[model samples]
Target chain A: MYKNILLAADGSNNALRAANEAIKIASLSNESVIDIVYVADYEKTKEDVLHASSADELMIERRKKIQNVEKALKDNNVSYKVTILHGLPGPEIIKYANERKMDIVVIGSRGLNSLQEMVIGSVSHKVMKRVYCPVLIVK
Target chain B: MQSLKQQWFGNVRGDILSGIVVALALIPEAIAFSIIAGVDPMVGLYASFCVAVIIAFVGGRPGMISAATGAMALLMVPLVRDHGVEYLLAATILTGIIQILFGIFKVAKIMKFIPNAVMIGFVNALAILIFMAQVPHFIGISNMTYVFVAITLVIVYTLPRFVKAIPAPLVALVILTAVAMFSGFELRTIGDLGNITQSLPSFLIPNVPFNFETLQIILPYSLALAIVGLLESLLTAQIVDDMTGTASNKNKEARGQGIANVVTGFFGGMAACAMIGQSVINIKSGGRGRLSSLVAGSFLMFLIIVLGDLVVKIPMSVLVGIMIMVSIGTFDWSSFKYLAKAPRTDAIVMLATVIIVVYTHDLSIGVLAGVLLSAIFFVVKISTLKVERKNSHYIVKGQLFFASTDGFIDYFKSTDINEKEITIDFSNSRIWDDSGVAALSKVKDMLRDEGIEAKVIGLDTSSQKVVQQLDGISSSH
Candidate 1:
């Protein structure tokens, strides 16, 4: 049932938990694929650039963060693929999942929740409803 | 009649047309909301009256009419259903009293905290929910029938092209009603539930026995009403402010709303809030002064007294049509589309709000979800806003506020982990508020936690002076 699992990482503790769970699930399955996705919310690059330190420098820093995740996967002895996508994190993850026909998705339950989540929306809830495959949201 | 220009009726041309437009719109909404709130439709009407009259006079923003809205209406359902109508009214009155206190205390400052992203998400989610909710009405079916879906789709696609200033929902209502009524097409109508009351509202409250259990039961409903009322009124004030290039006195409006709800409760009415449709209609028409809303309220009373039978005669189909149009107009589709292209957090927040609102029965849950999502977006958004490191120390000038604190932390922590000693060059920084102080304190804590040495420079002593002081204090050669 857990052939191809997608682990969502937002550099948050919960996402790491979900990642760990995905790795454990993969290890248990023995014949499964693990994929890590980090979505860089770069939609406001132009606005952020005006007040930001520097775009090139930020990208370098972001790449390094992703590389760290890659290193973590390597250390865990998990054969994994990492995708650093620039788009809405939830939708992008869902889109990637649907496109790949991933069997399951794991994410942190408490990733980046704020007051705006009350009136605005949450990514995990949206994915839980929209996605066809099973999704595990870990607190 | 008074002087030539002082006719009690005001300008009949635009006002009457706008009134009819507003009436057409309000009637169905009032009815739907009454059912949603689990109260007699008359309560909704009465609420619409009280809110319109009171806010018209005391409201901060002109062209912003207050009324019994679906958001507030839905909250009443559990209250009326669980505690009976009498207790619900008592809670409403208490809510009003609280609102007045909010006004006196000037609690409008809270509105500022409502982030723009959350606001947009809220409006967008409301738009989708309202649009979907009206599908059955648009297609000329009322009982969640499948036939209405095709009709709604066809009408949604084709009607806007043919219709102009006359709202499409009205057209849909007329056509559908004609098809249903004249052609004897099988469908449901408000007439099916019960006869539309032909009698005017008498000043009376049901004498159902009340208890603390009842009050406790209605607590959630009142809180829900308060949140919905606050959100709706503030949002409407914002819209009116945008339209008229005016600013809103939020605290005053909240107090005003509170007063209106209390009065409404006393009068056997449900919760009331600022009505976006009526306000826009008021502006689009010749409603210039508080008189417009006052007249709207008085007009409802007058109609109930003199033309109750005629009002009851107005087809539910017509009201449904007006609502369908309103639902369509209320939706911020373009922004919904734009949110798709926004930051992942924002997009996620918006989508989650829409889903929760659509699926859940409780309105507060959706709002709570949206707010939490927005907070996350704010944090992440602020985190991405970075500080530049100039020289050996990090120099950050400008307002070192809470909004930019995350970015500062991210930059400082990442940099300090690599650098041995660092100074936050804040001498040139303009500390706007205590939020800056809080951020600085946080940075201090983070440095201590990470076992790195960090200090604030250029405060009482200039950066150069601080360097000199440090050099003078150094015991090592």
Candidate 2:
């Protein structure tokens, strides 16, 4: 039973599929809880802050990235808590998973940007390569 | 220990290769910035080597490169022009001291105050400045100079597509210099600018009188240099952090830049800071550790010592073309889109920053103005004191500051309150300064003239305290 499941969500369609997988794994054990992690890349802080009317609006923008996944999780009755991490998606996800000694990580095979993934390798690839726990890649 | 190892030598092959590439890139830049600062090319070269090497061990950002930057050079033009290299060296040392103090005092906390618009403006302004400095070298000099420059640009921009082993700028330098030398083309060479001593830089005190007069002469320039140097350094570090998805010790970097500049000054070199162009080159080439910076600095010295004679024979037009490339790379071209898409105030701040820096040729002043302008815009944005009426009661919201006080008074002057007893609520808003309280008193007087008794209620303890403390309000109570 994957008791401590870490789900990486980025509002991508693939991430919703990953969340469904996380719910499947988490429901196996009564003690299990899927920890939903959304990483807001620091690279966009400048543009995001400039475009946003206020700090509240900036948070709303970031929250929108995980809104779909949260709704899916709610519909499944999966026990979960959302945590926002700041930095690069792949490395920060890896760091968070390792630090918490996550029993398993469930991430999507692709994210919002295929071009970035193609150029620098995907976040899932980096996470799968670096994370110490078992990683479930939902295509 | 685990993370330190990861930070230093996480990728060896990448670090060294990138380091070498960065070293090659630094040469033309170091020499070009030297000429811009009006010093001998060796001073800039020595400063780049010293700053890069020292910053590797001591700097807060591991992957970021620090060396003789054009921003610092632009700041130095007046100093070097007025009192010569000795005074410039003196100013460099003093600049280091000021930076160290800034680090100790944790000035890095204020970096968030620099909005993105201003940052884009700063980058674009610096790009404009870099291009402006290179104008006289190749402009209308000769048809030959123009040809060499065009060829250099072509090679630098296009060669990277075919060749991945070497840096494009170095390739441009080598190929163009060889053609000019072997073909005996009449060109303005680096040698024509200034004599470059082939020997290594040595420790020597600046030959300026140790008196108050000397301090008075260099202090202003030193302060300006320190501020601009640290600003650019911190900005570059932030860029590197975003690129690598890692955090940096910014305060430590401030001190490290100070230490590097101090050592560089003692070694008879001008002040230096982070070079963004070279830094991006390092990142793209797979540099991810302090070792890359170490290699970059040491390898630059190696190149200089082994190829000093060859360096002098290089045509200045090639350097001009490369610097033009640098300016192109340094400028945030997306800022054009940003101006169209961004808020009006943000656009103004960015444009103001660019125009002021380009006009004054002083980054510190330009940045100061941008920060001040942005601050004013921010205050104006947040101080939108809203007075919403719900029947006989008025609810006040948002910050009530001096800036919004006049508007708060005007709201009362314009509105005709029909209620005999109108309750003004201050529960949702906080009053700041005496002007806010004075505005409240003026509102009460205006409402009284309208034959309406304003019953003030919902005052938070702090707002009540402020209202009671005002002289007229105490008598009215």
DockQ, all models? 0.01, 0.13
Candidate 2 is graded, for docking, as incorrect
Worst 10 residues of 1 chain A by lDDT: A43-52
Candidate with top lDDT is 2
Per-candidate TM-scores read: 0.60, 0.80
Candidate 1 lDDT, tens digit per residue, B1-477? Answer: 123243224455654555545554455577666755667677788788777777766666555678777667656666677667787788787778767877787777766665545555555556555555555554645453445444544574476555535545545555665565566655556555334454444565545446687667667777777877887787777555544433557887898888888778877778788877667656555454455666677666666556554444334445554555556656655564556666677667667776787677456678788888788777655434445676667777554556776666666666635565778777656444455555666677777777767776666333344334444433321
Best by TM-score: 2
Per-residue CA lDDT of model 2 for B1-477, tens digit only, reads: 128788787888999999999999899999999999999999999999999999999999988899999999998998888889999999999999999999999997787778877777888899999999999998889999999989989998888767877988999999899999999989999999998787789999999999999999999888989988988888777667655657789899999999999999999889999877788778868898999999999999999999999999999999999999988887777788888998999999999999999999998888899999999999889978889999999999887878889778888888877889999898888887788888887788777777888888887888777877786554345
lDDT of 2 at B107: 94
Candidate 2 vs. true structure, TM-score: 0.80
TM (B chain), model 2? 0.92
Model 1 residue B85 lDDT?
Answer: 77
